[model samples]
Structures are given as C-alpha cells and as structure tokens.
Target: MIRLMFLLPILLCLGWYYFLRVNGVPLKQGKRGFIYILAFSTLVLGFFVLMMHLTNPG
Candidate 1:
C-alpha cells in the first residue's frame, strides 16, 4: 500500500506525458502538462492520506 501510493503518481505522470506527446504537443507544452499532472497527483495523494487517517482503527 505504501509503495503504491508513491508509484501511482509516477505512472500517472508518465501516462500524461505520453498522451501529450502523442497529440503532437511540444516539449514546452509537455513541461506545462507535467506541472499540471504533479499538482493533480499531489491532491490525489493528499486525499489518500486523509482517507487512511480517517479509517485507521487506532
């Protein structure tokens, strides 16, 4: 689970990169796309952390 949390963002970013490249976006545009992916990944990771915190039966 811990590993997955880290890996998910990387895979998502790679997919985003490929998608942009396939659509003929330039490297500059791809950089911007990466920034967007990073921001979105951060939000997703934060949500997962919050959910984990809420559900832990400590």
Candidate 2:
C-alpha cells in the first residue's frame, strides 16, 4: 500500500498525459497542460488518502 501510494501519482499523471495526447491537446507547447495534470493527480491522491483514513477498520 505504501508503494502503491507513491506509484499512483506517476501512473495518474501519465494516464492523463496520454488522454490529452489522444485528443490532440498540445502538451509540449503549453504549461497549462502540465499544471492540469499535476492538479488532477494530486486531487486523486488526496481523495484516496482521505478514504483510507476514513475506512480503516483496525
């Protein structure tokens, strides 16, 4: 789980970049694209962590 937490961000970011490229979103030419990916990945990680904290049964 600890390792997964670290890997999830990279996977999420790459997946987002790929999604954008598939739709022809000019990632290399715009700073905003990178920022959007970073923000999206962070939000997903935050939500994952929050859910883990809330659902711990121990």
Candidate 3:
C-alpha cells in the first residue's frame, strides 16, 4: 500500500504536467486553479495514508 500510494502522486503529477503542457497553462498551474488542486492533493494523500494504515495495522 505504501509503495502504491507513493506512485499514485507521481502518476498524477505526470498526468497534470502533460495536461498543462498541452494546454499551455504554465508550470505554476495558475493561481486560481491552485486552491482546487491543493484540496485535491490533500484529499488524495490523506486518503492514501488512511487506507494504508488501516489495511496494514502491523
């Protein structure tokens, strides 16, 4: 779970990077859209951590 959790962000970043590059949204992701992404990042990371800890309580 830890292994996959880490990879997911990397994949999401790559996908976002490519999407921005193709759309010319700049590397910063624009100020207005940042908040939405920040929230999403928090949710995704939080969920991953929670799930991992819950499933592997060793």
Candidate 4:
C-alpha cells in the first residue's frame, strides 16, 4: 500500500506530461524540470507521512 501510494503521484505526473506533449504544448524547460522535481517530492512526502504516522502509532 505504501509503495502504491508513492507510485500514484509519479504515474499521474507522467500521464499529465504525456498529455501535454501529445497536445504539442511547448512547456518551458524550467517548468518541466520543476514538475519532475515536484512529482518526486510528492513521493518523498508520502514516505514522510507514513513514517510520521508509524512513529506516533497510537
């Protein structure tokens, strides 16, 4: 379940980028890079959230 949660964000981001590319939307390189970073951050945040809850499991 934890791995699935992390993968969800990444897959969604990839689908979004693919949609944009297919539509021929010319996104700036910086913006594209930021999106990738944000997607990865989403995955990291999921991990942190899991850890936080586990640490305080009450």
The Cα local distance difference test for each model comes to 0.82, 0.74, 0.70, 0.70
Candidate 3 residue spans exceeding 4 A from truth: 31-45, 48-58
Could you tell me which residue pairs clash in candidate 4? none
In candidate 2, clashing pairs total 0
Full candidate order by lDDT, most accurate first? 1, 2, 4, 3
Those runs of model 4 whose alpha carbons end farther than 4 Å from true positions after fitting are: 29-58
lDDT of 1 by residue, 1-58 (tens): 7658778768878898788779988878678778877888789889888998999999
| TM-score-based ranking | 1, 2, 3, 4
lDDT of 2 by residue, 1-58 (tens): 6547677667767776788789887767655756876787688778888988999998
At residue 44, candidate 3 shows an lDDT of: 88
TM agreement with the true structure for every prediction: 0.70, 0.56, 0.52, 0.47
* Stronger candidate by TM-score (2 vs 3): 2
RMSD of model 4 against the true structure: 4.1
Find the candidate with the highest lDDT and give its number: 1
Q: Can you list the residue pairs that collide in candidate 1?
A: none
lDDT of 2 at 54: 98
Candidate 3 local lDDT, residue 33: 52
Best candidate according to TM-score: 1
lDDT tens digits, residue span 1-58, model 4: 5546666666666776787688787666436755776768777887788888999958
- 1-58: candidate 3 lDDT, tens digit per residue: 5556566556666776778888889876454454565567778889877887899959
